[model samples]
Target: MKIAIIGAGGVGGYFGAKLVKAGHDVHFIARGEHLKAIQNNGLVVKSILGDFRVANLRATEKITEIDQPDLIILGVKAWQIKEIREDIRKVLHKDTVILPLQNGVLAADELSEKIDKRNVLGGLCRIISKIESPGVIHHIGVTPTIVFGELDKSITERISGIDRIFKSAGIESTISEDIEADVWRKFILICVSGLLAVSETTYGELRETKETRQLMIGLLNEIFLLSKKAGVKIESDFVGKAVAFIDTFPPSSTSSLTRDVWDQKPSEIEYQNGSVVKMGEKHGIETPINKFVYSCILPRELKARGLR
Candidate 1:
């Protein structure tokens, strides 16, 4: 398969490197020092499962330079989907499948709005990894796994083919009956842990405090309500299930949002918590907790991007 990875960060770099090593044709669309590093040395993945490299890769900042791809995996920040869709569309053929592993529920919908819906797939990734340095990605925790399916949740040949491609690369994957709910399941985990962790200091801090724990639950409940109103097929008692899931994380651990807020880098706040808030208003549901979290973090996020 000819694959194009847009944003060779942790998720893209790790998956793309593995695919390239599996002998599939992989081109990475990257920029700056990271692109130079991949061009000169290779894309290095220091994974807990294993370590490998893909050297002398076909990487470029321009999309038109590459051939038509069979699949395009989007690993950019959630806020970037709209901005990058046009460039991505330029490289698409009739059969190109766009898989967005962004940390949000609206990724497929957002892409479907701009690009052809036939080319879009609902997807989510479960991986705790990041670009540790130029050309280097570190997979620290959680075995990397990808879960994806069609918007209508059909088990088509394309889904089977993609699953086989992932399996061939030794990557774990699942074809979900409802990819949107799967996306929301991951979103709940992030928003609750992420918002509370950002509001407090650490997972330890929130876990230790009953008040903060309740706050996290409050935020999650609002998300649950919004999910139901939006017609997502999530369980009614998901808040309880999500709390148990959050407990599995290490106490000292923080979410990508918490780290981004601390580092003052751009984050997926607008896509995750902010999306909940907007959806809440649209559905006439109260989301005080999400609103509070979004209000507290928006300033820093804007400043980080120089929008302030």
Candidate 2:
């Protein structure tokens, strides 16, 4: 399959390397030092699954240079989806499929608004990875898995093709029966952990302090309520499930958003916690905890981007 990876960061870099190793014609779109490094030294993936390198990397910074792709994996930040929508469209064939793996609930809908709904797939990934260096991707956490499906959750030939592609590369993959619900489930996990990590430094601090733990529960409950109000059909006691997952985390663990904040980089605060606040207002649901977390993180996020 001819594939194009739109944002070759940690997610894109790692997955793209795997597909390339599987002998797929994958084109990577990246920028700055990362792109330069991949062009010069190829892409390196140091994964717990095992390490490998792709020396024959086809990488570029310009979207116009890419051929029409059968599939496009969006590995950009949530906030970056709309910004690159048209550029992505420019590289699409009529049947091109776009899968967004960013950490947010609205990725598919956001892309559907800008691109054709037929081309957008609801998707999420389970992995903890980052660019260890300019051209190097390090997979540090769970085995990478891609869970995706049509917005309506129908099993189609294209979806099966994608499943086969990932498995061929030794990447775990699944097609969710209800991708929308799955997306919300992931949103709850990330937002709760990310918000608490942003406010309290680490999961250890949040778990150790009863007050912060209560705040964490409040955040999850509020978001769950909003999801219910929005008619996402989430589990009845999702907060309990979320709290259980939190307890399993390593004490020193911090979310990707918290790590970005510590590194003074721009984050997905607006799409994560901030989205809960915005969606709650839309649905006439009160989300006080999400509002508080969003308010606290916004100023820091803006300052990190020099927009404060």
Please provide TM-scores, in order, for all candidate models, with all chains considered together: 0.94, 0.94
Total clashes in model 1, counting residue pairs 3 or more apart in sequence or in different chains? 0
Q: Taking the tens digit of each residue's C-alpha lDDT, what string does model 1 give over 59-113? A: 9988788788999999888888988888888878999999999998878888988
Any idea what lDDT model 1 has?
0.86
Q: Give the TM-score of candidate 1.
A: 0.94
Model 1 lowest lDDT segment of ten: 192-201
What RMSD does model 1 have? 1.7
**Model 2 agreement with the true structure over 157-204: per-residue lDDT tens digits:** 999999999999888999888999999988987887466645766777
Off by over 4 Å in 1: none
Clashes of 2: 0
In order, the Cα lDDT scores of the candidates are: 0.86, 0.86
